[model samples]
Target: MDKVNNFELGIIGCGNMAKAILSGIFSSGFLKPHQVTAYDVNPETAAATEYEFNIRMAGDLTNLTLNTAKLLVSVKPKDVGAVTDSIKNVFAPGKNTIISIAAGVPAGFYEKKLNAKAPVIRVMPNTPVLVNKGIAVISKGKYADKEDLEFAVKVFAGLGEYVIVDEKLQNAATAISGSGPAYFFLIFKLLVEAACDLGIKIEDANKLVLDTMEGSAEMLKKFNSDAGHLIKMVASPGGTTEAALDIFMKKQLDKIIKAAVNGAFNRAEKIQDKILHGD
Candidate 1:
Protein backbone atom coordinates (compact mmCIF):
# COMPACT_ATOMS: atom_id res chain seq x y z
CA MET A 1 0.00 0.00 0.00
CA ASP A 2 1.30 3.43 -0.91
CA LYS A 3 1.47 5.68 2.13
CA VAL A 4 -0.82 8.67 1.66
CA ASN A 5 0.72 12.10 1.94
CA ASN A 6 -1.17 15.13 3.21
CA PHE A 7 -3.42 16.29 0.40
CA GLU A 8 -4.15 19.91 -0.61
CA LEU A 9 -6.66 19.11 -3.35
CA GLY A 10 -9.56 16.65 -3.24
CA ILE A 11 -11.56 15.24 -6.12
CA ILE A 12 -15.13 14.20 -5.33
CA GLY A 13 -15.53 11.98 -8.36
CA CYS A 14 -12.87 9.78 -9.95
CA GLY A 15 -14.22 9.58 -13.51
CA ASN A 16 -12.36 9.89 -16.84
CA MET A 17 -12.39 13.70 -16.73
CA ALA A 18 -11.01 13.64 -13.20
CA LYS A 19 -8.34 11.18 -14.27
CA ALA A 20 -7.42 13.44 -17.20
CA ILE A 21 -7.06 16.32 -14.78
CA LEU A 22 -4.80 14.21 -12.57
CA SER A 23 -2.72 13.17 -15.56
CA GLY A 24 -2.32 16.75 -16.76
CA ILE A 25 -1.42 18.05 -13.31
CA PHE A 26 1.09 15.28 -12.81
CA SER A 27 2.61 15.65 -16.28
CA SER A 28 2.89 19.42 -15.85
CA GLY A 29 4.56 18.95 -12.42
CA PHE A 30 1.88 21.25 -11.05
CA LEU A 31 0.94 18.78 -8.32
CA LYS A 32 2.03 15.33 -7.25
CA PRO A 33 -0.31 12.38 -6.77
CA HIS A 34 0.25 12.35 -3.01
CA GLN A 35 -0.79 15.98 -2.73
CA VAL A 36 -4.22 15.08 -4.10
CA THR A 37 -6.90 12.71 -2.81
CA ALA A 38 -9.97 11.39 -4.61
CA TYR A 39 -13.29 9.69 -3.93
CA ASP A 40 -15.75 7.84 -6.13
CA VAL A 41 -19.08 6.22 -5.32
CA ASN A 42 -17.75 2.90 -6.60
CA PRO A 43 -15.08 1.42 -4.36
CA GLU A 44 -13.50 -0.50 -7.23
CA THR A 45 -13.21 2.63 -9.34
CA ALA A 46 -11.62 4.59 -6.52
CA ALA A 47 -9.21 1.74 -5.77
CA ALA A 48 -8.27 1.47 -9.44
CA THR A 49 -7.63 5.22 -9.60
CA GLU A 50 -5.50 5.04 -6.44
CA TYR A 51 -3.37 2.30 -7.97
CA GLU A 52 -3.21 3.87 -11.43
CA PHE A 53 -2.29 7.35 -10.22
CA ASN A 54 -0.74 6.42 -6.87
CA ILE A 55 -3.06 8.86 -5.15
CA ARG A 56 -4.90 8.40 -1.88
CA MET A 57 -8.50 7.27 -1.86
CA ALA A 58 -10.79 9.06 0.56
CA GLY A 59 -13.13 6.85 2.60
CA ASP A 60 -16.11 8.94 1.57
CA LEU A 61 -17.29 12.39 0.59
CA THR A 62 -16.85 13.62 4.17
CA ASN A 63 -13.32 12.25 4.34
CA LEU A 64 -12.37 13.98 1.09
CA THR A 65 -13.68 17.36 2.24
CA LEU A 66 -11.95 17.07 5.57
CA ASN A 67 -8.60 16.25 3.97
CA THR A 68 -8.19 19.04 1.41
CA ALA A 69 -8.52 22.82 1.14
CA LYS A 70 -9.54 22.81 -2.52
CA LEU A 71 -12.25 20.41 -3.66
CA LEU A 72 -13.17 19.58 -7.24
CA VAL A 73 -16.73 18.37 -7.65
CA SER A 74 -16.57 16.40 -10.88
CA VAL A 75 -19.68 14.33 -10.51
CA LYS A 76 -22.66 14.36 -12.89
CA PRO A 77 -24.96 17.38 -12.65
CA LYS A 78 -27.76 15.27 -11.22
CA ASP A 79 -25.43 14.04 -8.47
CA VAL A 80 -24.16 17.50 -7.52
CA GLY A 81 -26.86 18.18 -4.94
CA ALA A 82 -26.24 14.96 -3.07
CA VAL A 83 -22.48 15.48 -3.07
CA THR A 84 -22.88 19.06 -1.85
CA ASP A 85 -25.24 17.94 0.92
CA SER A 86 -22.74 15.36 2.09
CA ILE A 87 -19.87 17.86 2.34
CA LYS A 88 -21.77 21.03 3.27
CA ASN A 89 -20.94 20.76 6.95
CA VAL A 90 -17.28 19.96 6.36
CA PHE A 91 -16.78 22.84 3.90
CA ALA A 92 -15.48 25.91 5.69
CA PRO A 93 -16.08 29.43 4.43
CA GLY A 94 -12.93 31.41 3.46
CA LYS A 95 -10.89 28.27 4.14
CA ASN A 96 -12.16 26.01 1.37
CA THR A 97 -12.90 26.55 -2.32
CA ILE A 98 -15.12 24.31 -4.44
CA ILE A 99 -14.62 24.04 -8.19
CA SER A 100 -17.39 22.24 -10.07
CA ILE A 101 -17.12 20.75 -13.55
CA ALA A 102 -20.65 19.38 -13.66
CA ALA A 103 -22.37 20.46 -16.88
CA GLY A 104 -25.42 22.74 -16.65
CA VAL A 105 -24.96 23.07 -12.89
CA PRO A 106 -24.49 26.61 -11.64
CA ALA A 107 -22.25 28.00 -8.89
CA GLY A 108 -25.24 29.42 -7.04
CA PHE A 109 -26.55 25.90 -6.61
CA TYR A 110 -23.46 24.91 -4.68
CA GLU A 111 -23.42 28.20 -2.77
CA LYS A 112 -26.99 27.62 -1.65
CA LYS A 113 -26.23 24.07 -0.52
CA LEU A 114 -22.76 24.60 0.95
CA ASN A 115 -21.43 27.42 3.12
CA ALA A 116 -22.40 30.77 1.64
CA LYS A 117 -18.93 32.20 2.18
CA ALA A 118 -17.15 29.34 0.49
CA PRO A 119 -16.00 30.31 -3.00
CA VAL A 120 -17.44 28.35 -5.92
CA ILE A 121 -16.06 28.22 -9.44
CA ARG A 122 -18.03 26.64 -12.28
CA VAL A 123 -16.19 25.15 -15.26
CA MET A 124 -17.13 23.49 -18.56
CA PRO A 125 -14.29 21.36 -19.91
CA ASN A 126 -14.29 19.03 -22.93
CA THR A 127 -12.93 15.49 -23.31
CA PRO A 128 -9.80 16.59 -25.20
CA VAL A 129 -8.30 17.43 -21.83
CA LEU A 130 -7.30 13.76 -21.83
CA VAL A 131 -4.71 14.72 -24.45
CA ASN A 132 -3.79 17.95 -22.61
CA LYS A 133 -5.30 19.99 -25.48
CA GLY A 134 -8.74 20.79 -24.08
CA ILE A 135 -10.40 24.17 -23.60
CA ALA A 136 -12.15 25.16 -20.38
CA VAL A 137 -14.53 28.03 -19.77
CA ILE A 138 -14.80 29.23 -16.17
CA SER A 139 -17.32 31.42 -14.37
CA LYS A 140 -17.08 32.86 -10.86
CA GLY A 141 -19.83 32.86 -8.32
CA LYS A 142 -20.86 35.78 -6.12
CA TYR A 143 -18.65 34.70 -3.21
CA ALA A 144 -15.67 33.83 -5.39
CA ASP A 145 -12.94 36.47 -5.75
CA LYS A 146 -10.34 37.14 -8.43
CA GLU A 147 -7.87 35.06 -6.44
CA ASP A 148 -10.27 32.12 -6.43
CA LEU A 149 -10.84 32.46 -10.19
CA GLU A 150 -7.07 32.64 -10.80
CA PHE A 151 -6.50 29.56 -8.68
CA ALA A 152 -9.05 27.63 -10.75
CA VAL A 153 -7.51 28.97 -13.96
CA LYS A 154 -4.03 27.79 -12.92
CA VAL A 155 -5.27 24.29 -12.20
CA PHE A 156 -7.11 24.08 -15.55
CA ALA A 157 -4.16 25.63 -17.41
CA GLY A 158 -2.27 22.44 -16.65
CA LEU A 159 -4.73 20.64 -18.92
CA GLY A 160 -4.88 23.26 -21.73
CA GLU A 161 -6.10 26.76 -22.56
CA TYR A 162 -8.85 28.43 -20.52
CA VAL A 163 -11.20 31.38 -20.92
CA ILE A 164 -13.21 33.32 -18.36
CA VAL A 165 -16.85 33.89 -19.33
CA ASP A 166 -20.00 35.04 -17.61
CA GLU A 167 -22.22 32.36 -16.13
CA LYS A 168 -24.97 33.30 -18.61
CA LEU A 169 -22.67 32.37 -21.50
CA GLN A 170 -21.75 28.97 -20.04
CA ASN A 171 -24.48 27.19 -22.02
CA ALA A 172 -23.13 28.59 -25.29
CA ALA A 173 -19.63 27.55 -24.26
CA THR A 174 -20.92 24.09 -23.44
CA ALA A 175 -22.54 23.91 -26.85
CA ILE A 176 -19.48 25.10 -28.74
CA SER A 177 -16.32 23.90 -26.96
CA GLY A 178 -17.93 21.24 -24.82
CA SER A 179 -19.70 19.49 -27.67
CA GLY A 180 -17.52 20.80 -30.47
CA PRO A 181 -15.09 17.87 -30.59
CA ALA A 182 -17.81 15.38 -31.42
CA TYR A 183 -18.91 17.54 -34.33
CA PHE A 184 -15.40 17.64 -35.74
CA PHE A 185 -15.03 13.91 -35.15
CA LEU A 186 -18.22 13.16 -37.06
CA ILE A 187 -16.91 15.17 -39.98
CA PHE A 188 -13.64 13.28 -39.83
CA LYS A 189 -15.49 9.97 -39.86
CA LEU A 190 -17.51 11.07 -42.89
CA LEU A 191 -14.41 12.21 -44.72
CA VAL A 192 -12.67 8.90 -44.05
CA GLU A 193 -15.70 6.99 -45.29
CA ALA A 194 -15.82 9.12 -48.42
CA ALA A 195 -12.14 8.40 -49.09
CA CYS A 196 -12.73 4.67 -48.59
CA ASP A 197 -15.65 4.88 -51.05
CA LEU A 198 -13.24 6.42 -53.53
CA GLY A 199 -11.25 3.13 -53.45
CA ILE A 200 -8.65 4.18 -50.88
CA LYS A 201 -7.54 1.54 -48.38
CA ILE A 202 -9.09 1.89 -44.91
CA GLU A 203 -5.78 2.58 -43.17
CA ASP A 204 -4.72 5.03 -45.86
CA ALA A 205 -8.08 6.78 -45.74
CA ASN A 206 -7.81 7.24 -41.97
CA LYS A 207 -4.28 8.62 -42.28
CA LEU A 208 -5.19 10.97 -45.11
CA VAL A 209 -8.23 12.37 -43.28
CA LEU A 210 -6.40 12.80 -39.98
CA ASP A 211 -3.29 14.39 -41.52
CA THR A 212 -5.38 16.80 -43.54
CA MET A 213 -7.36 17.81 -40.46
CA GLU A 214 -4.17 18.23 -38.43
CA GLY A 215 -2.50 20.31 -41.12
CA SER A 216 -5.57 22.49 -41.51
CA ALA A 217 -5.76 23.09 -37.76
CA GLU A 218 -2.05 23.96 -37.64
CA MET A 219 -2.44 26.36 -40.59
CA LEU A 220 -5.39 28.08 -38.88
CA LYS A 221 -3.34 28.41 -35.71
CA LYS A 222 -0.23 29.67 -37.48
CA PHE A 223 -1.97 32.16 -39.72
CA ASN A 224 -4.10 33.63 -36.91
CA SER A 225 -6.81 34.22 -39.51
CA ASP A 226 -10.51 33.37 -39.59
CA ALA A 227 -11.42 29.96 -41.01
CA GLY A 228 -13.24 31.67 -43.90
CA HIS A 229 -10.06 33.52 -44.82
CA LEU A 230 -8.12 30.27 -44.86
CA ILE A 231 -10.81 28.59 -46.97
CA LYS A 232 -10.52 31.44 -49.47
CA MET A 233 -6.77 31.01 -49.47
CA VAL A 234 -7.10 27.33 -50.33
CA ALA A 235 -9.97 27.52 -52.86
CA SER A 236 -8.93 29.29 -56.05
CA PRO A 237 -11.36 30.06 -58.93
CA GLY A 238 -12.33 26.87 -60.86
CA GLY A 239 -10.26 24.76 -58.42
CA THR A 240 -11.22 21.32 -57.00
CA THR A 241 -11.41 22.79 -53.46
CA GLU A 242 -13.78 25.51 -54.70
CA ALA A 243 -15.90 22.90 -56.49
CA ALA A 244 -16.21 20.89 -53.25
CA LEU A 245 -16.90 24.02 -51.22
CA ASP A 246 -19.62 25.06 -53.66
CA ILE A 247 -21.46 21.80 -52.99
CA PHE A 248 -21.25 22.40 -49.23
CA MET A 249 -22.45 25.98 -49.62
CA LYS A 250 -25.32 24.93 -51.88
CA LYS A 251 -26.34 22.34 -49.28
CA GLN A 252 -26.39 25.05 -46.60
CA LEU A 253 -23.85 23.27 -44.38
CA ASP A 254 -23.36 26.39 -42.28
CA LYS A 255 -27.07 26.58 -41.50
CA ILE A 256 -27.12 22.88 -40.60
CA ILE A 257 -24.16 23.32 -38.25
CA LYS A 258 -25.70 26.38 -36.67
CA ALA A 259 -28.95 24.50 -36.01
CA ALA A 260 -27.07 21.53 -34.55
CA VAL A 261 -25.12 23.79 -32.16
CA ASN A 262 -28.30 25.61 -31.18
CA GLY A 263 -29.91 22.26 -30.41
CA ALA A 264 -27.12 21.49 -27.95
CA PHE A 265 -27.42 24.91 -26.35
CA ASN A 266 -31.16 24.55 -25.90
CA ARG A 267 -30.80 21.07 -24.40
CA ALA A 268 -28.22 22.35 -21.92
CA GLU A 269 -30.57 25.14 -20.80
CA LYS A 270 -33.40 22.66 -20.32
CA ILE A 271 -31.18 20.34 -18.30
CA GLN A 272 -30.13 23.20 -16.04
CA ASP A 273 -33.74 24.21 -15.54
CA LYS A 274 -34.62 20.67 -14.59
CA ILE A 275 -31.76 20.46 -12.11
CA LEU A 276 -32.54 23.83 -10.59
CA HIS A 277 -36.36 23.55 -10.41
CA GLY A 278 -36.80 19.77 -10.42
CA ASP A 279 -38.83 20.11 -13.62
Candidate 2:
Protein backbone atom coordinates (compact mmCIF):
# COMPACT_ATOMS: atom_id res chain seq x y z
CA MET A 1 0.00 0.00 0.00
CA ASP A 2 1.96 2.96 -1.27
CA LYS A 3 -0.12 5.80 0.09
CA VAL A 4 0.13 9.11 -1.68
CA ASN A 5 1.19 12.00 0.47
CA ASN A 6 -0.86 15.15 1.07
CA PHE A 7 -4.67 15.63 0.96
CA GLU A 8 -7.21 13.15 2.27
CA LEU A 9 -9.65 11.75 -0.34
CA GLY A 10 -13.27 12.71 0.19
CA ILE A 11 -16.35 11.67 -1.75
CA ILE A 12 -19.83 13.24 -1.86
CA GLY A 13 -22.85 11.26 -3.00
CA CYS A 14 -21.67 7.73 -2.28
CA GLY A 15 -23.65 6.20 -5.14
CA ASN A 16 -22.49 3.86 -7.87
CA MET A 17 -19.78 6.20 -9.13
CA ALA A 18 -18.58 6.85 -5.61
CA LYS A 19 -18.58 3.15 -4.81
CA ALA A 20 -16.59 2.43 -7.96
CA ILE A 21 -14.02 5.05 -6.96
CA LEU A 22 -13.84 3.77 -3.37
CA SER A 23 -13.19 0.24 -4.65
CA GLY A 24 -10.41 1.54 -6.89
CA ILE A 25 -8.91 3.60 -4.08
CA PHE A 26 -8.87 0.72 -1.59
CA SER A 27 -7.57 -1.79 -4.15
CA SER A 28 -4.76 0.53 -5.16
CA GLY A 29 -3.94 1.02 -1.45
CA PHE A 30 -2.79 4.46 -2.44
CA LEU A 31 -4.88 6.05 0.33
CA LYS A 32 -6.02 4.99 3.77
CA PRO A 33 -9.54 4.82 5.31
CA HIS A 34 -8.82 7.58 7.77
CA GLN A 35 -7.91 9.72 4.82
CA VAL A 36 -11.29 9.14 3.15
CA THR A 37 -14.63 10.57 4.26
CA ALA A 38 -18.03 10.38 2.56
CA TYR A 39 -21.59 11.68 2.87
CA ASP A 40 -24.71 10.57 1.03
CA VAL A 41 -28.41 11.41 1.13
CA ASN A 42 -29.27 7.74 1.48
CA PRO A 43 -28.42 6.85 5.03
CA GLU A 44 -28.41 3.12 4.33
CA THR A 45 -25.98 3.47 1.45
CA ALA A 46 -23.82 5.80 3.52
CA ALA A 47 -23.78 3.50 6.54
CA ALA A 48 -23.23 0.31 4.54
CA THR A 49 -20.37 1.73 2.49
CA GLU A 50 -18.78 3.29 5.58
CA TYR A 51 -18.76 -0.03 7.41
CA GLU A 52 -17.60 -1.99 4.37
CA PHE A 53 -14.73 0.38 3.58
CA ASN A 54 -13.96 1.04 7.26
CA ILE A 55 -14.13 4.74 6.60
CA ARG A 56 -15.97 7.52 8.38
CA MET A 57 -19.35 8.68 7.06
CA ALA A 58 -20.75 12.03 7.99
CA GLY A 59 -24.52 12.29 8.25
CA ASP A 60 -24.52 15.79 6.85
CA LEU A 61 -22.60 17.43 4.04
CA THR A 62 -21.38 20.03 6.58
CA ASN A 63 -19.32 17.41 8.39
CA LEU A 64 -18.48 15.34 5.29
CA THR A 65 -15.50 15.36 2.94
CA LEU A 66 -16.12 19.02 2.08
CA ASN A 67 -14.98 20.03 5.60
CA THR A 68 -11.88 17.79 5.42
CA ALA A 69 -10.27 16.26 2.34
CA LYS A 70 -10.30 17.03 -1.39
CA LEU A 71 -13.89 16.50 -2.53
CA LEU A 72 -15.35 14.48 -5.38
CA VAL A 73 -19.00 15.31 -6.15
CA SER A 74 -20.47 12.19 -7.73
CA VAL A 75 -24.09 13.20 -7.43
CA LYS A 76 -26.43 12.82 -10.41
CA PRO A 77 -26.69 15.88 -12.63
CA LYS A 78 -30.29 16.71 -11.78
CA ASP A 79 -29.58 16.30 -8.09
CA VAL A 80 -26.69 18.73 -8.41
CA GLY A 81 -29.06 21.63 -7.89
CA ALA A 82 -29.84 20.52 -4.36
CA VAL A 83 -26.26 19.54 -3.64
CA THR A 84 -24.91 22.91 -4.69
CA ASP A 85 -27.17 24.75 -2.28
CA SER A 86 -26.48 22.25 0.51
CA ILE A 87 -22.68 22.50 0.37
CA LYS A 88 -22.44 26.22 -0.33
CA ASN A 89 -21.73 27.26 3.26
CA VAL A 90 -19.38 24.38 4.05
CA PHE A 91 -16.83 24.63 1.21
CA ALA A 92 -13.22 25.45 2.08
CA PRO A 93 -12.02 27.21 -1.06
CA GLY A 94 -8.21 27.18 -0.91
CA LYS A 95 -7.84 23.99 1.06
CA ASN A 96 -9.95 21.57 -1.00
CA THR A 97 -9.90 20.69 -4.66
CA ILE A 98 -13.39 19.83 -5.93
CA ILE A 99 -13.84 17.22 -8.64
CA SER A 100 -17.31 16.63 -10.07
CA ILE A 101 -18.46 13.60 -12.07
CA ALA A 102 -21.98 14.82 -12.76
CA ALA A 103 -22.62 14.95 -16.50
CA GLY A 104 -23.68 18.19 -18.20
CA VAL A 105 -23.07 20.21 -15.00
CA PRO A 106 -20.25 22.49 -16.02
CA ALA A 107 -17.55 23.51 -13.57
CA GLY A 108 -18.56 27.11 -14.12
CA PHE A 109 -22.00 26.23 -12.79
CA TYR A 110 -20.47 24.97 -9.54
CA GLU A 111 -18.07 27.92 -9.20
CA LYS A 112 -20.98 30.28 -9.51
CA LYS A 113 -23.14 28.35 -7.07
CA LEU A 114 -20.50 27.60 -4.45
CA ASN A 115 -19.20 31.17 -4.62
CA ALA A 116 -15.73 29.81 -3.96
CA LYS A 117 -12.38 30.00 -5.70
CA ALA A 118 -11.73 26.31 -5.15
CA PRO A 119 -10.14 24.45 -8.04
CA VAL A 120 -12.76 22.42 -9.87
CA ILE A 121 -12.06 19.52 -12.23
CA ARG A 122 -14.95 18.22 -14.31
CA VAL A 123 -14.90 14.51 -15.08
CA MET A 124 -17.05 12.39 -17.38
CA PRO A 125 -16.68 8.75 -16.39
CA ASN A 126 -18.73 5.93 -17.84
CA THR A 127 -20.60 3.13 -16.01
CA PRO A 128 -17.80 0.75 -16.87
CA VAL A 129 -15.99 2.24 -13.90
CA LEU A 130 -18.00 -0.25 -11.89
CA VAL A 131 -15.78 -2.95 -13.41
CA ASN A 132 -12.63 -0.80 -13.27
CA LYS A 133 -12.38 -0.86 -17.10
CA GLY A 134 -13.80 2.64 -17.53
CA ILE A 135 -12.66 5.38 -19.87
CA ALA A 136 -12.68 8.80 -18.19
CA VAL A 137 -12.36 12.18 -19.86
CA ILE A 138 -11.35 15.12 -17.70
CA SER A 139 -11.41 18.87 -18.26
CA LYS A 140 -10.03 21.51 -15.93
CA GLY A 141 -11.92 24.55 -14.82
CA LYS A 142 -10.58 28.08 -14.38
CA TYR A 143 -9.12 27.71 -10.88
CA ALA A 144 -7.83 24.12 -11.09
CA ASP A 145 -4.02 24.18 -11.08
CA LYS A 146 -1.67 21.63 -12.62
CA GLU A 147 -1.30 19.89 -9.27
CA ASP A 148 -5.05 19.65 -8.94
CA LEU A 149 -5.38 18.26 -12.45
CA GLU A 150 -2.60 15.77 -11.76
CA PHE A 151 -4.33 14.65 -8.59
CA ALA A 152 -7.61 14.14 -10.43
CA VAL A 153 -5.75 12.17 -13.11
CA LYS A 154 -4.17 9.91 -10.51
CA VAL A 155 -7.56 9.23 -8.88
CA PHE A 156 -9.35 8.41 -12.11
CA ALA A 157 -6.37 6.44 -13.44
CA GLY A 158 -6.93 3.91 -10.68
CA LEU A 159 -10.32 3.17 -12.27
CA GLY A 160 -9.00 2.90 -15.86
CA GLU A 161 -7.48 4.88 -18.72
CA TYR A 162 -8.07 8.64 -18.51
CA VAL A 163 -7.46 11.53 -20.88
CA ILE A 164 -7.31 15.22 -20.15
CA VAL A 165 -8.78 17.22 -22.98
CA ASP A 166 -9.46 20.90 -23.52
CA GLU A 167 -12.82 22.26 -22.39
CA LYS A 168 -13.97 22.48 -25.99
CA LEU A 169 -13.40 18.74 -26.40
CA GLN A 170 -15.19 17.78 -23.20
CA ASN A 171 -18.64 17.43 -24.79
CA ALA A 172 -17.33 15.26 -27.60
CA ALA A 173 -15.43 13.10 -25.14
CA THR A 174 -18.58 12.83 -23.06
CA ALA A 175 -20.54 11.69 -26.08
CA ILE A 176 -17.91 9.18 -27.19
CA SER A 177 -16.85 7.68 -23.86
CA GLY A 178 -19.57 8.63 -21.37
CA SER A 179 -22.31 7.18 -23.55
CA GLY A 180 -20.14 4.86 -25.64
CA PRO A 181 -20.47 1.80 -23.44
CA ALA A 182 -24.22 1.71 -23.98
CA TYR A 183 -23.73 2.00 -27.74
CA PHE A 184 -21.21 -0.85 -27.79
CA PHE A 185 -23.39 -3.00 -25.56
CA LEU A 186 -26.34 -2.43 -27.86
CA ILE A 187 -24.25 -3.57 -30.82
CA PHE A 188 -23.11 -6.64 -28.93
CA LYS A 189 -26.68 -7.43 -27.96
CA LEU A 190 -27.88 -7.13 -31.55
CA LEU A 191 -25.09 -9.37 -32.82
CA VAL A 192 -25.85 -12.03 -30.22
CA GLU A 193 -29.60 -11.82 -30.86
CA ALA A 194 -29.04 -12.13 -34.60
CA ALA A 195 -26.85 -15.15 -34.09
CA CYS A 196 -29.51 -16.85 -32.00
CA ASP A 197 -32.10 -16.08 -34.65
CA LEU A 198 -29.86 -17.76 -37.17
CA GLY A 199 -30.28 -21.09 -35.30
CA ILE A 200 -27.32 -20.79 -32.90
CA LYS A 201 -28.26 -21.56 -29.31
CA ILE A 202 -28.69 -18.33 -27.29
CA GLU A 203 -26.07 -19.34 -24.71
CA ASP A 204 -23.63 -20.44 -27.38
CA ALA A 205 -24.26 -17.27 -29.37
CA ASN A 206 -23.54 -15.11 -26.31
CA LYS A 207 -20.34 -17.02 -25.54
CA LEU A 208 -19.32 -16.82 -29.19
CA VAL A 209 -19.91 -13.08 -29.24
CA LEU A 210 -17.89 -12.57 -26.06
CA ASP A 211 -15.00 -14.79 -27.14
CA THR A 212 -14.89 -13.48 -30.72
CA MET A 213 -14.93 -9.90 -29.54
CA GLU A 214 -12.15 -10.56 -27.05
CA GLY A 215 -10.12 -12.57 -29.60
CA SER A 216 -10.53 -9.86 -32.23
CA ALA A 217 -9.33 -7.28 -29.72
CA GLU A 218 -6.38 -9.50 -28.87
CA MET A 219 -5.57 -9.73 -32.58
CA LEU A 220 -5.34 -5.94 -32.75
CA LYS A 221 -2.96 -5.97 -29.79
CA LYS A 222 -0.76 -8.68 -31.38
CA PHE A 223 -0.76 -7.22 -34.89
CA ASN A 224 0.78 -3.93 -35.94
CA SER A 225 -1.62 -3.70 -38.89
CA ASP A 226 -4.34 -1.07 -38.95
CA ALA A 227 -7.97 -2.03 -38.51
CA GLY A 228 -8.69 -1.71 -42.22
CA HIS A 229 -5.88 -4.12 -43.11
CA LEU A 230 -6.83 -6.59 -40.36
CA ILE A 231 -10.44 -6.45 -41.46
CA LYS A 232 -9.39 -7.00 -45.08
CA MET A 233 -7.30 -9.98 -44.05
CA VAL A 234 -10.25 -11.59 -42.30
CA ALA A 235 -12.62 -10.80 -45.16
CA SER A 236 -11.37 -13.01 -48.00
CA PRO A 237 -12.54 -12.30 -51.52
CA GLY A 238 -15.72 -14.14 -52.59
CA GLY A 239 -15.92 -15.82 -49.18
CA THR A 240 -18.64 -15.68 -46.48
CA THR A 241 -16.88 -12.78 -44.78
CA GLU A 242 -16.65 -10.88 -48.04
CA ALA A 243 -20.29 -11.60 -48.74
CA ALA A 244 -21.19 -10.14 -45.35
CA LEU A 245 -18.96 -7.15 -46.03
CA ASP A 246 -20.66 -6.61 -49.38
CA ILE A 247 -24.04 -6.58 -47.72
CA PHE A 248 -22.83 -4.14 -45.07
CA MET A 249 -21.33 -1.88 -47.71
CA LYS A 250 -24.50 -2.06 -49.79
CA LYS A 251 -26.44 -1.02 -46.71
CA GLN A 252 -23.98 1.83 -46.07
CA LEU A 253 -22.98 0.59 -42.64
CA ASP A 254 -20.13 3.08 -42.38
CA LYS A 255 -22.53 5.93 -43.03
CA ILE A 256 -24.88 4.47 -40.42
CA ILE A 257 -22.08 4.33 -37.88
CA LYS A 258 -21.15 7.94 -38.54
CA ALA A 259 -24.77 8.99 -38.27
CA ALA A 260 -25.16 7.14 -34.98
CA VAL A 261 -22.10 8.85 -33.51
CA ASN A 262 -23.26 12.22 -34.72
CA GLY A 263 -26.68 11.63 -33.21
CA ALA A 264 -25.08 10.97 -29.85
CA PHE A 265 -23.03 14.17 -30.11
CA ASN A 266 -26.09 16.21 -31.00
CA ARG A 267 -27.99 14.71 -28.08
CA ALA A 268 -25.16 15.46 -25.69
CA GLU A 269 -25.12 19.09 -26.79
CA LYS A 270 -28.87 19.28 -26.35
CA ILE A 271 -28.53 17.80 -22.89
CA GLN A 272 -26.08 20.50 -21.90
CA ASP A 273 -27.80 23.44 -23.53
CA LYS A 274 -31.49 22.61 -23.29
CA ILE A 275 -32.10 20.06 -20.55
CA LEU A 276 -29.62 21.48 -18.10
CA HIS A 277 -30.57 25.06 -18.76
CA GLY A 278 -34.29 24.72 -19.49
CA ASP A 279 -33.78 26.30 -22.89
Which candidate wins on lDDT?
A: 1
- Alpha carbon deviation, residue 274, candidate 1 (Å): 1.2
Q: What is each predicted model's overall lDDT from 0 to 1?
A: 0.88, 0.81
Clashes of each: 0, 0
Model 2 spans with C-alpha error above 4 angstroms: 1-7, 275-278
lDDT of 2 at 18: 89
For 1-279, candidate 2 gives per-residue lDDT tens digits of 542323377788888888889888778876778878888888889889988889988778766634565788988778887877787887766666779898887777778778657678999999888999898899998898998888888788889889888876778887788888888788789999999889999999999998998888789878864788899889888899999889999999999888888888887777777534566
Collision pairs in model 2: none
Q: 28, model 1: CA deviation in Å?
A: 1.4
Report how far residue 52 has shifted in candidate 2, in Å: 1.2
